[model samples]
Target: MGQEFQGGVGQVAEGDINNYGININLPDKPEFRGLVTAQRKELHELRAKCEELGDDPRDVWRRVHAQLGVCSISEITAEQFHEARTVISGRLEQLQEEADKRRLMGKILRSTAEKDARQEMLNFCDLSFGRTQLSHLKRNELQRVLEFVQQVEINPQPAAEIPQVQTAEPLQLREFLLMYKTNAAGLFLFGIFVGRFWS
Candidate 1:
């Protein structure tokens, strides 16, 4: 009869045989099975979250490993799991914020009248604020640009005035000629009527 080891698997007796003559070697720290399972599930969830946020899961894992001083997720202890979760969650939040800002910028640019309004805004930002991309601008700077664009839309610049042609002299001469012709015809008719009445 073989004695069962009360300690961890690390101190298990070598060459332990089962009833079917198969040697079984248990994993280290059998008591940590639950913790290990939970940690793996959390890691998978974190990776999915990274994908949803359009971030690289590998980079997230790198940050977690660096923060927790572990090469692999399996090596992370129960205490370190919380720290790793915090790091990953914070990164996801940051990514989400950046994505939202980008979406808002896109919406603002699309609301403009010009077909290439996005490029125009990019140029404006570069010239006025020294930022080539809207993404580079801070929240306040973006707000300023938004206000300026809205103001421009509200009060557009006036179009150039058309030059008037010099036709006043011609118009006056034409009117004078028309009046003279009318008066001459009226006098001729009056003279003819007077002669007929006398006859």
Candidate 2:
């Protein structure tokens, strides 16, 4: 028999009148830990997906919009979440493998600082910018180039002869921005602090 109360409807609580409307086991979920871990994993997976897409996956996930909605487990079924996770994870793995191959190709560019990496970086810049013919790129790609050059330790120099390549570690974003003001598109991508629509 179903419990009833002052509420004139089905499945109401004894003292208060909150209708469950559905059967929930009320399992030992360890709510905060379980939900938080799931949320973190989902977010991490989404970050990987965004990298594979070469653009923000938040737009695709409708995650920002959904956050506004405050969707519940009931609102978004677990199956949907599972499907999304699978697709994103698969793409992330594929992209990571391809990136490793590209990294190998990148190694050749690194071995000759002044000789090769500059031409390769310039070629990437051109291919990357394509029809726009613009030196500037989306801030993310600009950072990517800066990171690549730094990793390769490609230096600009007026040398008497082809200088020996020396691999310097990647520079911090601030240092790159300061050093390559002319080359860098001048912005940090993928970040926020104190969300607001500023005037």
Clashes of each: 0, 0
lDDT of 2 at 130: 64
**Candidate 2 residue pairs in backbone clash:** none
**Top TM-score: which candidate number?**
1
**lDDT for predicted candidate 1 compared with the true structure:** 0.72
Q: Number of clashes in model 2?
A: 0
Q: For each candidate, what is the lDDT?
A: 0.72, 0.54
Which portions of model 1 show Cα errors greater than 4 Å? 1-36, 113-133, 140-144, 147-199
lDDT of 2 by residue, 1-199 (tens): 5544553343334564444576455456542322345754785667666666564665545553254343433344443555545555655665565565455445534543545666666766677766322233544465566566556654557668867899999999889988988666533221232234342
Task: For each candidate in turn, give its C-alpha RMSD to the true structure in angstroms.
Answer: 10.7, 30.1
Model 1 per-residue lDDT at 119: 56
Tens-digit lDDT track for model 1 on 151-195? 553344688988978666545755766869887688789999999
TM agreement with the true structure for every prediction: 0.49, 0.28
